[model samples]
Target: MLATPVVFIFGRRFFISAFRQLRHGKAGMDTLVALSTGVAYFYSVAVMLLPTFWAKKGLPGHLYFESAAVVIAFILLGKLLEMRAKGRTAADIKKLMGAQPATATVLVNDQPQIIAVRDIQVGDQLLVKPGEAIAVDGAILSGRPLINESMVTGEAIPSQKESGDSVYAGTINENTAFTMRADKVGRNTVMASIIRLVREAQGSKAPIEQLVDKIAARFVAGVLCIALLTFFIWWAFGGPAELSRGIIAVVTVLVIACPCALGLATPAALMVGIGRGATMGILIKDAAHLQKLAGVTDIVLDKTGTLTLGKPVVQEGLWLDDDRDINAGYPKSAARLLAAIERSSQHPLAEAITSYAISVYGKDYSKNNDIDFDHNANAASYINSVFLPGLGVEATLGNDVYYVGNARLMAEKNIVVNAGSEKDVSPEKPVDFLTPMRHDLTAITSFLQAHTTHTIVYFAQKSAKDNRGTLLSVMALADILKPDALLTLQRLGHQGIGLHMLTGDNEAAAALVASQTGINRYLAGQLPADKLAYIKTLQTQGKSVAMIGDGINDSAALAQADISIAMSKGSHVAMDVAGMTIVGDQLSKIADGILLSRLTGKTIRENLFWAFFYNLIGIPIAAGILYPFTGFMLNPMIAGAAMALSSICVLAASLRLRYRKLK
Candidate 1:
């Protein structure tokens, strides 16, 4: 609706200034656009000096550019909203750091007084109350409590802690009060380190950013050269009535032919995707990872951190002596002997050992001569009479001295570990045993296939009183599966994806977790080289695999996968190899990332089609499409309108990507 070339010139000037400042300025995109808009507003006046202006209307005449004005306004407004939306993601990380109390209750001069977190010096004593954020990273000097370490693990389900246990800043004190010696203060805290990571990650550009810059440099020069040729050709072949023909064609080409939209497409989508992901509890390290993840078909998962809660739980326990029915030549009392060590154990694995015993034997365990250990004491519970002088818990029930702990415990006393019953299961040693319920992970694979758990070692030794000794039940335990493991596996399965579990955990636990989550392929008790080899095998078979891990041992495999996804809670080595990082450790977000990347790729193609089509079709016609027909020359005003509209269409096409529907 604007007045002729006046409206068109204004739009042309707008694109020129925006393109120029963005190309040359040492400012941000928002600042560049602002400065360019100002420069173009004045530059449009230059259009008046040409013959198109001198013959009729004066130099002050408007360019009459309605569409360009609309597009520029719309793009600027879209950019502002996008920036604000992304800013919320950064605020979340900062807000987490902000939650640490402004003031801390410190023991200064032996008196409790509130002071700033910065003022608390090292070696300062702090009394943490029940349900308080730990002011400083320190070791607990005294007391025991169930601390909720949701700050670190993101799992707030009350984990117990005692004296000598190390605690960090920002963890809520869930149980009794404790005295802690401040070891780290101020910037040395865990919270401080995480804040620093977020800052470093936010400011970093992806490898693709440099590629975009190179492409733009070549593209801009080429576009300008083509525009120059188009103008000269028209003047030579078709002839111009006035010198203004050169000016109109030159301005139209300069304003309309820009590669800015293409340059911004990938980065804009990346910025939005990563920022949006972080808000939903995921963090991608770079934009290239989005491109990488789109191609991944299979995912390799680590057993403990990725699939299970990583806590050892009690599943079942069997004592040989308690059973009334005999199995083969074994005694009916085999079940009771297993409970002897299981009952004395406090380990998470021991819970399963005793749990199995209680289910069969019933809960009537009473120690007539018991060692009364209280919540106040850091003590190992025992029924004193059953233990021998050196060998662990020696019960005379069947008159056998059964030992538990490690091979070192057995070697220390020079007790001969029975080879037939020993299951030596380390990736380094890899010993096999014939004993039932051996903790040695050597049989984790077979046990996993049968859906049994690892974490318990079973053995019995000869006693002088009972020289005709028997192999008694020594131990049984459980390792809890990772949290939300089943859900994660199910989500992957729903997408028709296959998952492989690569782990150093014993086969029994690894297989059990895999089965529980419906994972059919599990490689347990694997070395780092083994994991890497497996990844290579998948690669050789043309599988696009994604490896997810959270440990130093997983570095090689993580790097070997097509896309390496690192958990935010994982070790440094794992994070280093990972192409993408999940900031808040939500596995489900990975699925969302894949969907967004494909949609964005389709959008760029569609936009480029519109951009290329407008220029390719219109410029030839404006040059002289029907010179042999009616002999009516193409109007400079119409050419100007078509050129301006070309830029408008490209801008509109690119902006339409914002409305892409994501699954």
Candidate 2:
């Protein structure tokens, strides 16, 4: 009688939930446990309260109070262990949330004031001292510092941040104090976005999870039917003691067939897998994306930032006049004109030229007294400058008109190379500079072909008489390829993944990076819409495509891909459209994410197989299927223990994923 209260106390929740499910005309795993234990406990109560009632049947009047109470105790213990294990799966998200600081140092009236992070508003000047976490996303205003972005991007190396550079929240400053005007505060920060994504991913279910849920719902009703059939069949065919034997078999079947393991099979593995991905800096946005990642057969990569540093630097420049050697310096008059035109353009090549000119020549022509000019300040005098998309910039300085762009721009303006009559050069002689312009263009072209990776920017001028343009100079620039690019491509290639490069650059530059990085297929001069079309084409071919990019141009394609992966350094729109974000901008992590997904898929399969196998085998044995062969029946207490063990085993198998090694 004392033990009966123990069962009611520990098993109260289960019985209440089972009653609710029964009222709604639905059955769950709790229903089986509640019914089996309730029947045993009430039957034992009847014997204890009225011994003469059971004595009439000659049923031995055995009290089963201990059996029912012990079964509920064991099941409750298993549930507690499972809950603890599930709690460990989300520890990574907790660690990520802990990285953000609660307070910030805001500059007010030129004095430092400590305030809560949530109180910070846009345009507030914040101070970030060395080793302190950045309070919000902002642009640096004063001191230069090395920031450790590993918390956000997963790359451990410290990145140098100076004036005008953007910094994110939750990142730490390394060696200098800096003040920044806050640009994004509160939930607008990247850290907040990552947290939201991780939580949603953990809660969302995959397609397989839906299938498992459907089976679990039906599984309970099916188990009850089998138990009823087993009892009836045995009562109709067995000997005089069949009444008691049939009742034991019915209770055993209900006790041993557990749907808890079936329901836990998919969710447990997904939780561990997503949490593990977070620790590695791979933010999976949804459980369905994890499934899609494993099926990716083709990958499209953006050229500029994805494969290279995206910062181009001038390598060399060629002067058109033979009398003026480029090493000596470009002719003062033309250098000023070229510099003024390039400074007006925002293209990467133009920026490289402007930077190179400022570095090689002084800021002012008269300040140094060497007659070399700094045309950056003189750019205001040139009026009506027009930017031609994809071509170059056109501008006028005094009586001369200048053009700075690729060779295609020169061709579009009808500027002819090698058209001048005079070629021989002398400082004293008036040699036609236009004729030597063709020589420089040819030399730059040959150099670019030999290098295969340099971007050439051409300079041209219109003749006083002809009005059509003549080539003046060519500047070659190149961006640095990432150190891990080649190895990442090689590994992906070895895994039988088809790699293709999509870029807005010309063929030569694109080919060079592709070849150097071991990517065999490529598409050059692709616009944003074109890239999106290409992704759709690949999908039509029955290939699941993963598009990796980090710019505004890649946003459309990223949204169109089955699996979209964005680099950490990429634009906001790209990250917003992508299904997964590679936090460190490490190309190698792409392969790691894919490999982890495959492993997670395997784990889910193993869990489901074990869950289904346990139920199928246990249900039959509990129904007394082995009684005739072994002359023995399964005990209700042993059946309850077996049911609890099955759920514990599934949880243990899924927990193994937290320790699996990733690439």
Off by over 4 Å in 1: 1-64, 67-71, 74-90, 108-110, 206-216, 231-242, 255-589, 617-663
Worst 10 residues of 1 by lDDT: 371-380
Per-residue lDDT over 59-80 for candidate 2, one digit per residue giving the tens place of the 0 to 100 score: 5666666667765775665455
- Deviation in Å, model 2, residue 203 alpha carbon: 17
Best by TM-score: 2
| Per-structure clash totals for the candidates | 38, 2
RMSD of 2: 12.7
Instruction: Give candidate 2 misplaced runs (Cα > 4 Å).
Output: 1-206, 213-222, 234-251, 310-434, 437-445, 448-474, 478-480, 503-536, 551-560, 626-637
RMSD of each: 11.9, 12.7
Report the CA-based lDDT of candidate 1 relative to the real structure: 0.55
Deviation in Å, model 1, residue 627 alpha carbon: 5.9
> What lDDT is reached at residue 140 by model 2?
93
